[model samples]
Target: MRRTLLLLIGVFLASCQSGKDQKEDVKQEPMRTPEARKEVVYQVFTRLFGNTKTANVPWGTAEQNGVGKFSDFNEKALAEIKDLGVTYIWYTGVPHHALIQDYTAYGISNDDPDVVKGRAGSPYAVKDYYNVNPDLADDPAKRLEEFKALIDRTHAAGMKVLIDIVPNHVARNYEGKTNPNGVEDFGAQDRTHMEYHKDNNFYYIPGSAFAVPNWEGGYQPLGGEKNPLSDSRFKEVPAKWTGNGARSVQPGMNDWYETVKVNYGVRPDGTRDFPDLPEGYEYKGYQAHADFWADKELPNSWDKFRDIAEYWLDMGVDGFRFDMAEMVPVEFWSYMNSAIKLKNPDAFLLAEVYNPDLYRAYIRKGKMDYLYDKVELYDSIKHIVKGYGWTDHIPVVQKGLKDIEHHMLHFLENHDEQRIASPDFAGKAELAKPAMVVSATISTSPTMIYFGQEVGEPGKEQAGFGSPTRTSIFDYIGVPHHQRWMNEGAFDGGQLSAEEKSLRDFYKRLLNFTINSPALMGEYQDLHFFNKELNAKYDHRILTYARWSTGEELLVVTNFDEKKSYQLDLKVPQELLRKWKLSPGKYSLEEQLYGSVKSELLVPAGGAGEFRIELQPLESRIFKLLRP
Candidate 1:
């Protein structure tokens, strides 16, 4: 009997120890904030959003090819946009720019066709800072009111409004008819006799008269239309430096000749004429930068842009997208963006800075909220999508910029890039699925999509002044594929084909999941190297990673192959498994993007965990591990 009692006691002790081991193995990870929302910016060229015309005539007049008005973004249209998981709507080309349309009746001077780009002028060449584009208003007299109402409508629809702020330059004819009582137009008080001055807003070529560029390749103002203003002459006594810093009296066709460069107290000899930022200002926040500039004397150009930004902020603009931000000095942005933040602390200041070396300086010292990840991430993905590069290069790019990944916004399509469905790109919108998945979930950065990218806009129309493979920002033209999604103002996919509908549904599902997933906002670990060394079937065309938060763990895998299927056993390193505190057991792997797809994850004792995954061509999966 004593022997039997001792055996029972030994068995009880063994059971207790086993229970303790199991408890320790299944220790829960610390809880984290699950509602960390990722910003999804929808950049809609304001002039192209609502135009349902399919007549894509090159160099067509606004009368021939209908212009989309500000009123076109009605409640229904906004609802459709908001339903796409968009947090911000960047209303591009909202400001008054130099266009060919004559608004002389409204006390606005007509832009010379010799200087303007197309029927609709370049949005980068601003003519007035205080007014909205007259072409966008249903009634030209109430243009500002119409824009304000649009702002209200956008806010009511649960999204903020962003407009462009062209600081580096303005139209060659910088006329601001709607300037406020104390605000003067750019270059109004400039000393034209000298080439450079501390307060001069523009640099002038002394004793040189502006001459029109010799139009080549049969290109003419308005496609050789015989408007009175199309006489190929502009009245300027002293020719200013071209927008591209060209000093010739007449700029070449390739130069940015439609606009003139804005002087920011920088001398021709590269000497800064303005006060420099104090030492250690690079590590400061916007408020400190604002405070530092509050009492300091600044250049006239700096104050001018700050006033223009504040004016728009007062008019309910939530943010500004600075055009060619790298062209302007970083010091100027510190002052301008700080002033913007002072007015509205939550203002989103996105910039177009292409230089990778200048990215950190712009974001840190310039106080910019986000910069385009075009050169690194976007370029790499473009090559991969074109079937030229390897997915192995992506992890390298991410590791290099891991510190600033949140500030580096990722985008598959934007106004500056060719459409994904274009023959020059991937030739099919469906092929971008894996690329989009990687772009949206790979980091904690904002994801941006141009207006018609979801609908497979090929952008093949040879719109005037703009080449094929890119939608025209200069000409008055209709976007064919986007118009089908527009469905004649119903804002529904009434005219979309089955393939198009499926593609759009895929985008909607992925984007919504991105904003809602906590793991995406949490920590990221690259599993590409781990799998490449373990799984024989894994190739350079495949990418794998893991992301986890308190209650969510996600394994993201993407296959960039256009014609191959990958059947491989993806392994998670033992170190990461320990970091996740995943005990040895069976867990359910369920897909989050599309429902009803699942697999199993088997974690054996004292070894790397793995799951058998089969990826079809251009397929991506975000599998969530259902842990016990």
Candidate 2:
């Protein structure tokens, strides 16, 4: 039954990916805008990658504030990624947070004495959106300068640079004040006009930041019929409705304590305290919608966010990578995109929207310029490799990748989910190399490489039997383990292990492939899903696709299958297939050089028989076919 389920998943993933394909199918028609140029983006979680001698300097040491500096580029760490031919650097969450950042008042005891591998919290809990984190950019006056310098460095080293942006909520207590001392919540209407008590704290964002032992989820109301009287039990019901009780943001639906369900049309005190909202929205519908965003005044909220983005742009950030982008209204993104384009035309607006379902609309609506490709990671790479099986599901996932090739963000590791040591990676360095390689430099999408990925570091096995660590976004799963290596090597850290060396080399080669390939940079991404049969045995575990640039064609054939072999049949572009040493099977390309440069694979895989390649377990090959 488990095997069947896995097979089913492989097929589904190969076709319709994380809801993004459904959104794409609906086709929201917007007036055509001129296309943007191609970009080869590489993501780095500054702390987890490598500690530069100047940046962190200690290759093995993991700093609590994470590598400490905007210019903290890890040379040995980056060598592998750069070797894969990096074009842009998406340094994930490098911003700093002030000492006063905490949110224990809202609930989860926001205080953990032990630092995870000498690191502070995640960069998302923004101490001050207006200012760069001191740790990332210490020189307050030269903070923006440092960012520009980093970008210059990236460009000089053959890459562009981007940073993450967490806009939804600010740290509970930044600079000893709950609310940046009057930055204005900005979304809700003037409360004084509505005649509400000042000390009530409802409708006002809290002015405290804590370690939030628990991050709860569920809807909260923004504005509603004003409460007639102050009630202490307000903590017991939906605060958005009856002005009630506590709500938590803990992960998983299993957590009931984290939320106090809100009643949109009905108040908790039951006096019918709801108001009419935007056109076509009922009182109940409005409240439900508010819960989704954890914000009700979305109209104004979005406007404020757009302005905030402008402020950052003015500060000279290349652009932003909006966190949990799907949570934001699609309409709001359209507005933000339009506004942002007017200011920073070439700004790189990448979004942390993990699913494939939302990418098209996010991109089409202008809410985001790029999003992570979960399908490619889960079904394409992880399932085939970790699950260790091959079946009819391979081509299905490959086809999905083909459809959304241009705007997808390809990655094997990031700050979220389990570390490389978890079940996903399964402790096999050899498997990780091919898996990481295919993810980073194959398919014509921007590649996002996490900090420790290059060295194949198996992160700590999450605390609380890994549950608490799993749910804690402030600190990712990989940080703990990485820190051990740092401590063992003593702040200035140890030499790279052999496993680390090989893994690093694999990524470097793949990244360089993209940097050198011009075919990947074309305005449009042309991908072909080979092995088109509905039930080929190797179909589920194998993925095959080719990218076509203006004058270049590259194909990437990767086998996530483990110790399984099956007969394969694939379609070939008559023009290019014939041009290459003619063969019937599909081809693959080096992701790093898709559009920057090109290389033809003599034998992309283990050449054993039938003009085909015998792949040893998890293996990936990049081939350059003659351009049509």
Task: Tell me how many clashing residue pairs each candidate has.
Answer: 0, 84
Q: TM-score, each model?
A: 0.94, 0.63
- What C-alpha root-mean-square deviation, in Å, does candidate 2 show against the real structure? 11.1
Give the lowest summed-lDDT range of ten residues in model 1. Answer: 15-24
Computed on alpha carbons, the lDDT of every model, listed in order, comes to 0.86, 0.45
The alpha-carbon lDDT assigned to residue 86 of candidate 2 equals 63
Model 1: lDDT equals: 0.86
Please identify model 2 stretches exceeding 4 Å from their true place. Answer: 1-38, 47-67, 74-84, 95-119, 137-152, 174-299, 354-359, 375-377, 388-391, 398-403, 440-442, 461-494, 521-540, 562-610, 626-628
What count of clashes does model 1 give? 0
lDDT for residue 194 in candidate 1, whole number 0-100: 93
lDDT of 1 by residue, 11-56 (tens): 3223211111111121111223667868899999999999988787
The true-versus-predicted C-alpha distance at residue 296 of model 1, in Å, is 2.0
Local lDDT at 486 for model 1 = 95
| Candidate 2 structure quality by residue, lDDT tens digits, 1-628 | 1122334223322322222323334322211233323355666665443332222221112242234456555344344345556666777665544222233332212322121111245465444455554445545456657766666666556555677765433333222222344455422243422212222213322332212222235211111112222121112111221111223322122221221221121222222222222322211222233343444333344545666677667655677787656543454555566667767667777776544555665565434656777755545566555675443343455456554555677766665644555544555545655566556545446666655555555554331211321222333223433443344334322556666556656666666666556655542222223343433444555665555455565566566655765444333444444444445343333334224433333332333111244444566666565422
